[model samples]
Target chain A: MKRNKAVIAGIGQTEFSKNSGRSELQLSCEAIKLALDDAGLAPSDVDGFSTFTIDNNEDVDIIRSMGIETLRFSSRTPHGGGGSMATIAHGMAAVESGLCNTFVCLRAMNERSEARFGIAHMAPNSNNKGSGSGFLEWSMPFGAATPAAWTGIQAQRYMARYGLTNADFAPISVLQRKNAATNPLAWYYQKPITIEDHQSSRWIVEPVFRLLDCCQESDGGVALVITTEERARDLRQKPALIAHATQSIPFDTETVTNFYHKDLTVFDSGVQCAKEL
Target chain B: MTTNVKATIPANVPATMPRPQPLPGRDSAFFWDGAARGELMGQRCAACKLFRHPPRPMCPNCQSVEREEVRLSGRGTIHAFIHPVHPMIPMFDYPLTCVLVDLEEGIRIFSNLYECEKEDVRIGMPVEVFFVPTAGDKQVPVFRPARDAKAGSKGARS
Candidate 1:
């Protein structure tokens, strides 16, 4: 199979925190500017932008703020967290299609300090009427309102089938905290949670999850720059060559997915994506 | 092991916090409507005879546009559950034992055990469908201990 080549030229991110004390737009601009600087590219050199579809900041607003005059390519991916890694695929495609030379993928949000995604939103369909995809409505009314609750539904079934326990999942968080403790950029930097801490943590919903089971919602943003492999070699820094990326597959496992397979615990889409990648 | 003769929702639950209602859309209206009458309903792909939940328009197995409402046994076993300890959302009954039950009909539903404490619920615990009238003209299909749930009570470690 023939493929076009692209490379990640630079990466930039704001400090992780419960509060960034900055508007999302400002955070976005700051991250993007840092990425541009890291890539040794001027604002004028960036011609395209790609990000998650739910982003509040408009491309017009971003490019204008960056002083990039003529934007040629821009795109956004659906499904919020899935969009994080998915945009790199979009950027690669845009560059391969000759739509733009330099593509910037960015995301900025004040998840903890400003708005939150964990709130028990009214209905999955929402009273906002005709607002969302309505997938959430099925569980929302029953109190599986937050993202943790949403995923916990699946996690619950997985544990029950295998007879797994909290002790099984505690090591995952403990190891993550252990790693984060040494990383100065981490929210839990210099502070690690113990197995005891995980065991004693309060529940957000029961047997399979605890407060430590969840990642603390942090404020801030991150940005990345993508360009052609040929063009990337000429940039200021060593290019992180894009090995491969997967297409946007439907992330929803319950509805619109194949159930013929034996175990619902294993994600078929992920298996297929991994095999392909 | 400690066992409660009967499970119960905490007494102080706030009715003022309107329970989140099912947003029944065109694809799932039938399932929601059926639940209102105490029936656990799922969508059966007319072409494949496979059953599914949180109803959708077509069959993922056969790509068939045709589907039919399949009444379910409403009898299932606890597949997995979490005892949410924190009141991140004050609306939730603290220490809520949220569960995912794998129905005998080959689908999973997110619900809670109405009559048991967090300790009483267990993996593979048998439960039967029971309706909790949450909002006007809408009822949420919840689960409670089935008659045989006690047989599996030992499955619970705590």
Candidate 2:
């Protein structure tokens, strides 16, 4: 594949916290402003916008509040967390295709303070359409209401097929905390954990995941500025050139709750994305 | 190891707060209807003869809009199971176990497992489907250890 001349000019984020004490839109605006300032550009310079479909902050609201002079491109990627990085791909595509000269990509979530993903109950069928509803109709009636429950069932098959034990998962959590301990922006800054900590943590889903194995519910926002490599080189920051950016959703994969797929042990989408990259 | 944990909705939850019911849509009405009628249902691609669960309008294999409603054996092997321990919903009892059963028809279903000990649940264990009442007077499919399966036989670790 031919490489694009697009580059990431700047990145900015709000402080990671349990309660941001701000609306999701406000958090988004703050992060966008910070990202613009870091890139030595004004809101008016941004011609394209991209974000995850699940983001509560609307592009129109952001544009009206930020006083953007013109807009040429905008897109919303689906699949929640799986689409997080796809926002950058959308930006890169816009800039490289000359649809827009500069792009702003963002994700602002008040996940913890507002609706907690871990415990929030979604009514089955939820108006009887879209990706997860059909799967939920099958699973939720059986008491697997949460993402943990659904994912744990899939994870168990992989573990059992491979003859692995829960102890094998401890190192991942331990290493993640160890990295977070040194990063000032990390919520777990200076709080490194051990494999023992992971082992002793209470089970969220027995024999599949411990509490430590899961992500913390957080409230915050992050934004990135993308532009052509030539334009980025003229800006204040060093340009990080893009090599390859892509997203994939292979056949038989749902956004989540993928028990219907032929092989539970394999992540076909992730494999497809890796092969593409 | 069979503790015989009663396979029913948690007793403490008030009758007014029932479990969410399956709202069947055009593509999936037959499957839920089959559950209510105590029959396991799936769809087979009319062109390719491939079986699909949680029925959809078209088959991925042949892109065929034509499909045949098929009755499943309701007999399957437990391909995976989990016991969720935290963030408990009121409508369900604690120590609840959910399983992904690979049915004899080659399709998979997500359903609850009962009439077996939590410790005894294992991947590849043979199970047979049974209907259970959920909210809204609707019946959903669940599974129990197959009656003819020998006791004390461990599932393959590999």
Candidate 3:
């Protein structure tokens, strides 16, 4: 893991939307093509692929559709959004280890228009064998069905221990919306919220989370090109050097419905990951 | 809605959705069975003596396959609790409090907290487990504010 061994040459994404009116595979190909174009590389230049395990798009479909030449390496990391950064790490390792000359990392989703994870009735199917699936068995029977339901309890404990109220969280949402408002690509572009707005928002979980506190479900795709720093220097875009990339999964953690941990306030995995970094 | 109903649905809305069931595998059935029998069951490694929950086939510590079903003391303190209000489930009463409790046996359990006022629900508040009928006609462990516990005395356990 030598410093500056690998770098991100280009990044691209589809416009954020509630409905992309296209399949995830199409969105993935489009984003990847955009990334390749940005890097001044053709589809044939990509030799490796890295993405999330939960991503609906398949490597074979992408390779066939993009006409990529000589696919040599492919890997998918688990943990969905939590493992998102790991995709880049995988790509970096592929290129740095001399396994491949160029690698592409991607994530494409139809989160809103297709399947909604935030909906109460949309519990992860036990038969599907996916992340956070069986973990819901202990929870769903008790009416804790949604992600909000699973996360709300942990938020409550953290707030209570710190002597903080729900109002204390309003500023965070306000800041988030404020930042989004300034970004043209943001869903809430030009629409900043106030603390009063956050307070007035309907409660998703009483005394813990409001509607504003929750993340918006949207459909989109994003991809990145990773190659050796030496090769990246000649790319169209200025290369962003990768100093280090690592992922860690601590003991006693089960994805979002991680209720078994002794301490509800602390995310041991993040702490362990930071220590590794 | 009647005064005695645990959850409140909108007056005009029909409560049509069925609640999700555990569909427990062989390894985790003991826990659901213990709840049906008015007990909280946990798993302990027969070799290393370390306890695990949501039952697994093997112990991570010693890789021991031999394990025993241990009945845990239904006593614990509230580590965290939340009341869900949106995308309401018809089976559940509105303003329901779901709590994460740290058991006396050194494991945490996720169950709903009942018979407690919103203002009274706080972190480290002592609570005791009880069985409640939930979706799928399953008897699951829930919690209530412990009787005989002093109020305002935080039951913080590190």
Candidate 4:
């Protein structure tokens, strides 16, 4: 069957912050409404939804609250930020497959004030247990509790094998900050950092990084409305066409720490995704 | 009511209170113990004698359960490093330094290198362990440039 061809019709985001007064459900609804408005559509037009498992809101509750006409599809991806692009990938697939015409992809969290995902070792539960917990269990007892600590392992190894340094990572932060500065919706919007600033920042993990080199813990919501390309062209605003999308799991991949793998320096999953893109 | 009677309290306190748990299993116990002592430890197979971190009970190469705990020399070179611009979770405004160390024990350990100017942290610089304490009375072994080492050595490869 020919693919239906999907495109992003609208985008909406709440201000990023350490805390938001509203509940997670309220954040989800607000972003979804904004995206609908941007798309020149209504809650009644959305038939599908996709988000992450880490999100606290449920699909049924969201649909009921929004009064969506008919819920045709809904899904939750895993792996936190790694699933950012993957959520879009799934939405595009759902649209192209003719399973749903209007789909929404969203990430809503009060990472700082509510449930911080970056804490030193989260409790093991049904969703986070097994493979997820297994990977963490290996390091947490040894004091590698935080995500930075886990990534520090790979980051340090990468630095050792290559001729890279803390300065090299500064560029990455600078570029992202520059991009965020221009993006009014970004939490760090209007705030720019220099290499000197990055260097001067306090150390979070030694040799692997500094304070400015990390991402923020903001309480906000970001949403994208996806629909068929043919329909998107007829919409009020120009759509960012979905050129391609793919998700990947590298060989012998574990959640975050794949120490047992032959090569720990590179993120093979990301590399694979890049290749597909 | 004044009789000398022992009061029966609910025995649920032990169940409710959180207990100290080991991060690793029997196979990798040594790595955790070593970290508590501020030492970088890895597993070596009795057969092939290759070193591995996040220590496993069995050797990946030889599948030998007869493994030994080896103390790493803590001297290694940086393979790669990055300084994140955005604040990642639990690390607010914290700069990160990730390095791959080629241990003198013939094994490579990945850790954060610290205690110097972030600008001075070049790839291939010699580094040694600097243990940081944790909440559970355990210590984490981080790395930084060793004192009195040659300024710029070739970057270490995996």
Q: Candidate 1: interface RMSD in Å?
A: 3.3
Judge candidate 2 against the unseen true structure and give its global Cα lDDT, from 0 to 1: 0.80
> What is the C-alpha lDDT profile of model 2 across A1-277, one tens digit per residue?
4434988898889988899998999899899999989988999999999988667788889999899887899998877588888888899889998899889999999988996778836565453433344566777676776677878877898898898878898898888888878968767789998888889989888889998988887899999999998888679899888887899987777766778777889988789889989
Between which residue pairs do clashes occur in model 2?
none
Give candidate 3 regions above 4 Å deviation: A1-4, A122-124, A127-129, B1-18, B134-137, B147-158
**Which regions of candidate 2 are displaced past 4 Å?**
A1-4, A124-133, B1-17, B151-158
Predictions' DockQ, in order? 0.44, 0.68, 0.63, 0.14
Winner on TM-score (1 vs 3): 3
Note the Cα lDDT for every prediction shown.
0.73, 0.80, 0.79, 0.70
- Residue B100 error for model 2, in Å? 0.4
Between 3 and 4, whose DockQ is larger? 3
Which segments of candidate 4 are over 4 A away from where they belong?
A: A1-3, A122-133, B1-20, B23-158
| Best candidate (score: lDDT) | 2
For residues A74-93, what per-residue lDDT tens digits would candidate 3 score against the true structure?
Answer: 99888747777888889988
Alpha carbon deviation, residue A152, candidate 3 (Å):
2.4
TM of each candidate vs. truth: 0.85, 0.92, 0.90, 0.68
Task: Give the alpha carbon lDDT tens digit for every residue of A130-246 in model 1.
Answer: 224555666556666666776776676677677787679999999988987896766878999889999998766566678898877888788999998788878988998778887
